[model samples]
Target: MINEFIKNIKILQQLKDNNVYKKYIEYIRYPYFRNLAPDSKITFDFPVTFLVGKNGSGKSSTLQSLYGCPKGYSLGDYWFTTELDPIKEFDKNRNCFIYGHKNNGSVNEVIKQRIHRDKNPDYWETAKPIKRYGMSNSQRFSPIEKDVVYLDFRTELSAFDKFFHFLKFYSNTHKSKQDFLRFYTNKLKEAFDTNKIISYYTPNRNKPKVILTKAETKIVSEILRKEFESIEIIEHNLFKDWGTSIRLKQKNINYSEAFAGSGETAIVILVHKIFSASNESLILLDEPETSLHSGAQKRLMSFLIKECIKKKHQVVISTHSPFLIENMPNESIKVFSTLNTTGKFVIDNDRNYREAFHELEIENTNKKIILVEDKTAQILIDKTIEKLGKATQDIFVTKYLPGGADDINQRLTTIMEITDDTYVVFDGDQKKLQKPVDLNLMPPNQQDTSKKLKELIKSQTGCDVKFYLNGGDQSKELKEKESLKLAKKYLEFYKRNVFYLPLSIPEDIIWDKKFAKKLLKLMKPEKDFSLIKKTSSNSKELLFNFCIECYGDSDQYESTVLQFVSNWINKEDSNFRIVKDLINKLKN
Candidate 1:
């Protein structure tokens, strides 16, 4: 677990020099950290922790601050302190590994060793004995105490000469291909742990080359094939005075890294390095989604999660992919953003309201958002909005919430909290009832009417009425009137189309405009049907029932309404002016 190596991190008020800090403390600063919480504590509760933020929101800086500072490497100008695991009773030092993107455009993993000078480290000290505990830069040895290995994609494919030499030594020592592979895998793990710091002999003027047998080549090929479909290791080349080399085959063409797709090569290299990492190693991925398609990104993440869990490795990722973030435990995520001018801030991920809008991919922008009731309202609102010239390319774009009237309050609160430019458009039928009634409790008379309405609705419409009444006032008369009006408006929309379908059409009719029109008409029965209820708004219900008789189902009538509205909005029309006006009013 990461807590085993790093307990907590604290941003310092000043560097060792005590120079006046300008940005991190007073204003927006560099190297990622800004206005962080005092005694900021990040825990490793899950095997994987993801840091997500917008560009310049400090994801990279946070990673660097947490574990990216190599012992001897200069981190430019940033300062932070960490609480590490105390040295074991028998151990002389502690080591921490960090993997990150290096300044040279390559990924590097560094292992830094810390030795305690004071026997009694619990007490404060003006000065204490301390020294870098690991072997010299030229020497390599497995970490005997606390160690951290920072791995990056670039590092996985780097140190070409050393890698080839290591391969040669292992292949030469083991004749059995499987044994060679096992040994090879172990050595790679060692290299990853030590950051390739072990000693290497100076090469002689003539280097010895060791050829790999066909079986050995096949073993390597099979491994590559699993990652890259159809990719194979063609052969291994050993030169008398040169190091070892391997060739690859792809799509019947011989290729090397230089000629291969960088994405594929990067993936293979990164996966190989990960597989070679020792169990329980702290793994930090800057952005595994880089250089991968959506499918590949998901597959790689799944594979990595499984492998890390099985091996007890802890993984941290800093990324911007929703596909990566979705479905993970809520607490495992830490969302970062620079919304505050003073510094970056974190948003809670577990809030259900946030999750609901997250499904719409809401970003911090000036885009307009429209919250409506359901798919039917969504269609109507979108269609109406589109009729007002250009719908989506205006100064602000609009998206709708999928909830209905009852959800408006929560949706508005959540959305307005995120952005001020928003509009809540409810259905026209949601207008207040002519006579106010207690909405909190269902009335006995209304409850019976609801039952009758449900039966009438199901038999006449052949569609579930639950969705229509969801979040609606359950008053019998109001609901029935609203449903009838909605159905009436739908039929009106269909009849407005010159080619609206009739009762039925021949099965073999070609699916052209005529057949399409007939297919829509076939949704209804041939005879007219009437409801003999007396009401103030009987005209609307009468029209609705007429269309239901012709269409057989209220759902098909609604579908035709949506189709007509969609087509109407897509073409030249002027009826959306009222919607455009309402939106303008809401924004103002």
Candidate 2:
């Protein structure tokens, strides 16, 4: 079934020239994290999109790159972001637009903000200047709004797009208060409406057994739930029939340009729904996967592209799960680096990222890559030094677990037989680890980095690491004892008000169960529970299981028999294999 769907639909890159936003005043030239990945640059051009890449690569910054947001926007997608789905939103506060959490954050903040999501999406209902807890009198859709029609998905959507068209068509003939009669009359005439794209999802009736039977067709029902979240429909381009009931019309350049005769009612809903959401508005959205299948993501991306053909609405969102991108053209997608005002850079458009990074094609001289705990530290070294004009062609930064030098070493031994200029950052935990460097297969980034540490300590704390081996000072402690003391100091820096995950941890699990445990360990168990980013060990397991089921695990690794199993950890696609396989595996 999936193979048929995949075969029928081909994903193309829907490239658009997205003008990334940034404040004029706060531009930084050499930003601290300037070369940070996707969190840096951000852009907007489509109504729905899917962003993909490794964590810390600036994926979320693409959504939150609008003005009025608290801090300048960065790139990224956390757990359940729809920002990648190309739906944008601003905060109801009319504050700067914002999307998803920090770059180094969990994936599902929108889910965390459930009530927040419901509040403003319904704001369009009160056309006559309805104010929330905090609002000035100036905000409203338009003067004397005509009508309002809450399209309930239950019965309304099953008839599909033309269903509403028939309503308007019938109303033109029989100008009477007989909506139910009009519906039956339309059905009698075989004037049933339909959706060209998401038609497979069209339900027949409200009764469970009518379209999808829970008892008999449980699997199919589950598939419907996964794809058509809740199919609500509208007939026209406008909202309202009378007194602004719910009008629908097609634009010359509609969301679905190919379907010229009449745009899908779904596209009209998108425009009106967005317009209806807020005033001087900011919209925050998770993945716009709801009510849309992968095929629809492509159509929506094209149709929504022209929304900017008229209005310029600022949107912020997050998405780690990308169903939309799977359908997009290759050249269309852009990669971002950071969210801060000045540090943003686009991957595709920027002559630099593609030319410098991809084109020259740095040598895999050290093709034997070193997976750092937070490869960011190594990435910073490589990229920053590259900025300083160094050929880092040989260095490739991957991941090891945070606070996990031992794990890194263990995994390293399995992968590469020979190690070269490899690096590891260890906490040097006394009880947990041995010395200045805990079970390191490779030393830290460089010997110079270690030497720099010596100078840093000498200048600040008046202690010399050179004193231990070179016999310079009698007062200094031994390397192991001094490392423990220094480790305590480092841990203190790490466990400050907000904990920073140490390097040597898995990139995905950077904010995973272990991170939650760290938060609990740092603070009280109950109170810190909320403070922890969503992924704790249990959440990690659950998310992984879910991923396995939705998309198969084969994409997990290139050359592993356990590719499917390895794919469990990756949140690359919505059709996540891990969750699907795990369930089937369990059943079998």
Candidate 3:
């Protein structure tokens, strides 16, 4: 299901790039916003995007900015000047943002600034574009005309939680207080049993109705993993000045939000709002995973994607949930990182799931870990794993350590001690170090590290380790010696676990003559291979230059190149077989 979702998202991305599926707000840029660097821009390439980062990294601020993109919405609705937090009118650094939307086959930019007025303070209104050299002003446009539904899950409370926990009762005695609660509970039960609208005679009359449709009930059930006969909402004097309460009925069981799980109540409200929203509305969700379990979060994301496709809605979410971000296309995710020098958040738009996991400090403990020398090698192995099907892909995870083979080799003992399921892989160029004798040929630091590893293994097992680098072949003399059988046991562990790539380096496979030709045919058909060969000094340089020429020197160019390389390695070739065998061993 996740694979299909990702494939559909990729198709949508292609359509968006071709201008076939136009988005209301194409891109947003902020020259000076709170905690964000100057001139930081984020493009809404996909209809559904995720803004992910640590706490206080401006994720919610970015979501607020998007919420303010459509007409009739303003950031001041959420962020306003208080007594302690005031906005200065004469500040040198202004708070403003600019966004572009598609207008009749062209993009029209609108600039909004926080201007202080006598009547309205800290108000964001449309302002004239700032003049820049060599730039001319076309016809200005107004804010986008679309309905917006902004939901901050963190602040949302179930109808029951809000009423009982926050509201004040007139009775001061304990007995009177119990009677107050019983009166309200009985009234809510009567309303749910009769399936009738309940009204309250407060300063402002209020009536709550059952808003869930039959289809919406099923969706809510699936998302929350709960089956309900019926669900109703009641807003009466009991919840006056608070909010509505939800009454759920399940096979001989009846309860309100007071007894139901928090996640259940949140999903019920979320589904209702989404189903009732108008088509093409801009839906902004802040931390939708607030109370949802992992499974529920994924189902909610899947439902959001399906609804976005159906209604032509633009959905943007700010979250810290890996489950929500895992199945999303890398292009759909925008990572925010704080810079130490400036103490501001900077956008990193080229991160994949593994990199995002590292940023979030999340570890997939269920999957087997395969450690590689660098990012390129990791990509290659990951692509190969994908070809073995979804089950294989789900069983293994690849992580790349920086500083190449030396890093893994230096920390080999520590890594082994940490997890027995972990396996180390190196580039084919480092295959020379497979033999113990070759340790002497390494640099001084590496030689000392290798000696320490050897000594440690011998001391622990009381056996001298030997490496049969070539398919674990043992000499006749060594095989006959029963005394060295323990040595063979140690050799078998390394032989079975450690591995090297089939090619000398990642560039060799990525820039192979045949693979490079195929990639060029798709990316740049007019450019010949001779141009790349003559200009580049080595295979790595050739790969880099080809990517630059084809995709330009953008932040996404490197990932674009690796994606193509991964596709090339996904074939049923010698290298694929080698990687597949290694993965099978790990699986066993």
Candidate maximizing lDDT: 3
Candidate 2 lDDT over 1-588, as tens digits, reads 344333332321111222321111111111112234322333333322334433455444333332212222222222223555533334442212112221222211110111224534311112222234222344332212111112222122213233444445434644553554454433322311332211212433221111112221222112222222122232222112211112211222111111211222233334445545433233444444343333444444433333322233333333332434443334334443334584444444322212222211211233323334443334322332233232343333433456444444333321221223233333212123222322133354532243444444333222332221111111224334443444333322322211112232223322344433453355444343433234435433433433333344535222221222233234333222322332223222
Q: Count the backbone clashes (under 3 Å) in each candidate.
A: 20, 101, 0
TM-score of 2: 0.24
Q: Is candidate 2 or 3 superior in lDDT?
A: 3
Give lDDT for model 2.
Answer: 0.30
Model 1 scores what on Cα lDDT? 0.40
- Which structure is stronger by TM-score: 1 or 3? 3
- TM-score-superior candidate, 1 or 2: 1
The window of 10 residues in a row where model 3 has the poorest summed lDDT is: 467-476
lDDT of 1 at 133: 24
What do the candidate models score in CA lDDT, each in turn?
0.40, 0.30, 0.70
Instruction: Encode model 1's per-residue lDDT on 73-113: one tens digit a residue.
Output: 32222222336743342343223222222223322223332
Better of 1 and 2 by lDDT: 1
Off by over 4 Å in 2: 1-48, 52-318, 321-328, 331-336, 339-368, 374-395, 398-588
TM-score of each: 0.36, 0.24, 0.60
